[model samples]
Target: MQNSFEYGSTRVKPQRFGDWVIEEITVSEDEAKFFNMRQAFQGKHSEMITAGKFLRLMQVSTGYTVMSNTPMELKSNEIAFKNARGSVLIAGLGMGMILEAMLTKSEVTHIRIIEADMAIIQYVGNFFKDDPRVEIIHGDIHEYEPASDEQYDYIWIDIWDDIDVRNIEQMAELNERFSNHCINMNLWSMDLLGCEPEDYYKIAM
Candidate 1:
């Protein structure tokens, strides 16, 4: 059964944090499990919209439906995104759930996405192509050269399944570049962020 909201002044403040709000939130843990199951097996738009097992970060309201792809990068303790202005560069587009959130923040003006996997980039661009705020770059973030005079407010690195740690030297180089540019760098570690049986959940909770 669908849930309905009893109208109230403050309650109708348009539940929004960033670019999203509590569209609907399923209360029952069992319902959440069932919803997750449906997403895992089901295809169509649900698969694209769903954020896998990372939906826990959303502060689901008493009666609102929330769809997310994994816990949001900003909400995760291991992964962090800071508020800033001007252009931002993001590595590893993933399903673009984070990118969508980024667009909602008025502080962010332009977005340059770096993705190594063509297929994933293609998928996200195809789905979100209509958004004029995003600029897609299909190449290795390590190889791409930020404009000589370009200074970004933020640089987010989440290459590979999570943060690509195999290339420590490359990571160091990127960090150095970010430091030089006075840009805040964020590295999203899949080892820590990926859906695995780990005790970090306790800390996160």
Candidate 2:
């Protein structure tokens, strides 16, 4: 789908860091107004409403959702990418933002992306189709089993719809089972805030 945010008349070249490229676009005031109006009608409040600037990663297929301009989301990306290394496994591929960031890290060797939705895979696949370091697996995380010979150095999970105790438990369980021998395992819901597993469950209950 075409992005609802209008890219103003500015020739901004995409910036490349390692294997990842990011394009900066000017978000027109008119588009922002329309987006706010649509959100109001839908009774939704989004921090992603473009005001002046927006970033577009070439690796993502879903144009609108792929835009990353929010401060909180950007900070989360920073934390996640900083900890990524070696043969990595990511559970969710939302807009491929985390994937793009991880690709920029020289420490990351091979990345295995497991996405349950075929449409998301098809959309984001266009960006990384030529990259030999990436392997896209179409499967559900809950039922996923790594080959006996396969082992990852990092397992990052971000499939939760939102942060809650149940989601934390499920993600922790996945990590325990799939990445027991991995060097590191992280969850987007937990790692970003530096929240301990015990603390999270305690507060959640």
lDDT digits (tens) for residues 71-133 of candidate 1 = 333344124334434787787665465666566567778888887767555544566677787
Q: What clash pairs does model 1 have? A: 24-64, 24-65, 25-64, 25-65, 51-68, 51-69, 51-70, 54-70, 54-71
Per-residue lDDT of 93-143 in model 2, one digit per residue for the tens? 756777777776778899999988776576665578788999999999899
- Cα TM-score per model: 0.54, 0.63
Where does candidate 1 have its weakest 10-residue lDDT segment? 5-14
Residue 145, model 2: lDDT of: 81
Tell how far residue 78 is off in model 1, in angstroms.
7.9
CA shift at 12, candidate 2, in angstroms? 15
Off by over 4 Å in 1: 1-68, 72-81, 162-167, 190-205
**Deviation of model 2 at 170, angstroms:** 0.9
